[model samples]
Target: MSSDDHGLLPAELAEAARPAIAEARGKPARDAARILAEAGLTGVCAQEDDGGMALGLSFALAIAEEAGAGQLRFPLLDQILLAQAFAGQDIAGRIAAGEALGVIGWEGARDGLLRLSDDCDCDVVLVPTGQGADLIERAGLTATPTPLLDPDAPQIWLDVGAARKIGSLSGEQMADLRRAGEALYGGFVTGAAANALALSSDYLAARVQFGRPLSSKQAVRHHLARMKLLLEMSRAALARSLARDELGNPRDTRPAFLGAVGNAIWTLEKAIHLHGGMGFTWEVPLHYSLRDIRKIETAFGAGRLARQVAQDFIRAA
Candidate 1:
């Protein structure tokens, strides 16, 4: 098998998923989720016993990248990662059926509550703990949606109480889960960057300037080239990280995640610039991608988080 194929989806499965993903784009979030569920894309990495495809993380991440490209406002990552992290097989079954949504809830009690991830309108939230996770029901909590950078990306702070203990995750299990998260988010960044590049390239080609196509200019060509380079490098790094994970190498994944984030930011910015002011307007969707990247980057305390992961990896190594 080729290096790129390491733990990734088989060709048939990828092919089967593509059209469903395309059809889901621009649809309502829950509707899209159901569509994906119907297509069996939602359970790509879920266990076979749970009525899932029994595919691996690489397959999930590949689909996640496609989701990013389409910007199909659904909780694909949460379903694949957080739902699986949950203790009960019932939850897993619900996720595989696309009848439930899962989200990561922050640990600390903010005035007898915790804040969940953006766009988390779901039945349950998995609050990570020192041991495992606390599964909290949405009905038990009060959710107040907050304004965010990307309007499409909604968020909520919860007023919740004690949670039901599920089960504990071993250190190795926790590490693997985190790495899976990294792979999913990395795919998102890759898709966003790739989409931005495509958008900018298309705009430059069709747009006329100085009595000629903007893409005809050498400067524009160079900018496009740089964007392509950043995207490919980030993708390669992410692939390497995933490959390592598949090989049971326990290196920190933060570097690859951060690299993808950086590439997405740069490529999106370039795309906006190349669109020549039109990109900044809400009329165009390019700004939405930029906003999404920025929100995700800062929300995670990205730079500090990456550094800490690197240091931890170094010490362990």
Candidate 2:
């Protein structure tokens, strides 16, 4: 019965997310992320001592779905979850205290080089690149506001010398953290896709087409069905991965993680296409959600997921 509640998000998480996204629409998602840290919603996968909500991934996925539907750009999930995965520690309270602002850039080339604050939002940055605090001492970096397709855009500039490694991750732990980042990142995309579909659905249901509601069109109904299918697939993939983690099995999470990325990528692409010209324009917000999903898709190598899928197919064959 809350204004924003449509069953995609839990009552409390949905409420918290809606306002935080509203506040960030003016500034940046980084600015809105403070609410997540304060609410203890960011590090949902973190340990008890880590100042996290200690919530499970299914709940997180549900929240992500609503966030996407709203075209919300808050970095609560990205900053906090990535930070915890990087450090294996809960620093949400530090983030809430404003003593630190967490930001992450996925380091694909150097798995050993931990770039904790490459976004440089924090006063004391931690990097697995090296622990000399050298990254902190680098004063010649600038932050740039990179406007995304959405109103809530965040951008940062890193001076080449502005980062250094503080620690290293190896073996299974390293791989697990990487999967964690991909899964969480893709989860946000799934959320965004869900949001776009809802927006489109509402518009279709109300706006007249051929002297009737767009939803009355058989073709329109099909498009909506396709969107829902993709959305559900992404949600289930994320859920399965998180459930595995809950069951004390981390090894099989990668496929579920990758499945989400692939499903979200396809779903958002369809959403934008179905909305036609309006989806391309800034006046309509569906593009924002689509664009955000694309951003995460590219960052997490969604384009390459087909190869992984094919390999799995071959293995099964």
Candidate 3:
């Protein structure tokens, strides 16, 4: 990736997101989605020919990180990945224009009724069925509200029928798209972990006990150091993966993305502990960060399943 593109795009997008974050806070999710769309944030990686900026994988990850930092309620990951996957398709233009949203059933979801993400008024759901992109119009599907770990991210059950075939993707291409999803998840976790760490650090510095701030204690300082270390390492790994993606080499990203996601989870989980009992409650955003990270970690595949996939990818490399 060009050095200029690496830092500049993310920096500008993150800065531009400040007001959008404020506007989205404590409001219905549509407001957040609208804010992101209005800022051109929703279409960061969309093909320019399809009315999108076509910002590439690196920018897409940056957008995820920035959006996650604010705990943005929009389904940005879904939108960006789907936009890129379905580029040149009819729905792509609508997705770029913010006129519609898209979701993907990436985990072995083919035909039949399936529950995708929560209700975002998705216009189409793309099921990666190995052969090609199968498009299920919202009209053809039924959505029922479902619970989710991240309140910002809603879920719904869709009674999918025979979907209209729109495009095709090879197995390798589908795997790459899945890897992109994981990377985007990592980026989000990185942002959330960083935010949580900052919150805990600030809390420790301000929280006084035994005539000294909690941060004065060596143990507390160690926690802060570890959190910082994890955040930096994850960022570095993601940067490397992005560099590879920039060079048109997308393989082996799964390992780095998984490693980053695992580190981010640990960092945020510890961040919660550092906050003590208060962290367990809704009074602080730590709970939200922790919840979201944990959920995203397991979304596509969890525990041994996720590990095996990563190992397989690494071994094949």
Candidate 4:
């Protein structure tokens, strides 16, 4: 079914997702999966026959934004994309139903080690190959946790030498996944920036110094204005990336993704600064948002990505 046939708009999907995402925030991976799947979020883009809404990536992008805004730790974005990518497969149906969990290794397999974003509590994992990706069973793999960035949900390095490959995505499919991933991840970081902006604005408005609201200061106002500007630009970039070009072909999503990550990093850092000393402490939640965006930036190598975009432009020129 088409997105229009679902009788639900993207905004409505976001609204419906907020509460579920909020509830799933601190839950275990399996529990969070069930909560999201029961809410129909995990299958937002999967085929209808596979117990999904069969909506477009735009719908999934909306849900992704909510996941980001809520600071959810589960790999919801990967799950959603995998469900859609492996449509009609049993794994897809299981994922849509929340009976199975999957995670993707952002880095390609190197020296038998596959780097993952979150904990390895999943049933299977997608590891990047030379041209495509391999879906392999998670059992029999050694998971080495790296929790420096996010202690609660540490990154993991999986030894996949003994992994059993169950499925494979062709190069074309991998390309499609990358485009969709950029768009969804763009929305994800954009949501984090939005949340950080809200937090900063509210904090500054309430924070009084010398019997005056901090937000009333011109410097603070300027910072807030700049944050708002960047947030809107990120949103606009994401929206444009998801749209088809004039010739009815997909636009390159890397620019949007890169812009969103950079903007989010700047916004989060500024938000923390606006909080003064409180921002640096664990008492404030601003650090969580900052860490989340930074993790994505590091994972994707934002500087390298920006350089690649520039190189593409130069070649075209």
RMSD of each: 3.3, 6.0, 3.1, 1.4
lDDT of 2 by residue, 45-137 (tens): 454465555555555655665566566655555544544554433344455433356554444424323322124354433332222112132
Which candidate number has the best lDDT?
4
With a 3 Å backbone cut-off (N, CA, C), the pairs that clash in candidate 4 are none
Please report the TM-score between candidate 4 and the true structure: 0.97
lDDT, each prediction: 0.72, 0.56, 0.72, 0.87
Candidate 1: residue pairs that collide:
119-154
| Per-residue lDDT of model 4, residues 153-247, tens digit only | 77788899889999999998987887888889889999998998998999999999999999999999999999999989988888889888999
Each prediction's TM-score against the native? 0.87, 0.74, 0.86, 0.97
User: Lowest-scoring 10 consecutive residues by lDDT in candidate 1?
Assistant: 1-10
lDDT of residue 86 for candidate 2: 42
Q: How does model 1 fare in lDDT?
A: 0.72
Clashes of each: 1, 16, 4, 0
How many clashes (backbone atoms < 3 Å, residues ≥3 apart in a chain or on different chains) does model 3 have?
4
| Rank ordering of all candidates by TM-score, starting from the highest | 4, 1, 3, 2
RMSD of 3: 3.1
Instruction: Determine which window of 10 residues in candidate 4 has minimal summed lDDT.
Output: 1-10
Where in model 1 is the C-alpha error above 4 Å? 1-12, 86-88, 106-113, 163-171, 245-247, 313-317
In model 1, state the lDDT of residue 13.
62
Q: Alpha-carbon error at 31 in model 3, in Å?
A: 3.5
Scored by lDDT, model 4 comes in at 0.87
Worst 10 residues of 3 by lDDT: 1-10
TM for candidate 1 is: 0.87
> Which scores better on lDDT, 1 or 4?
4
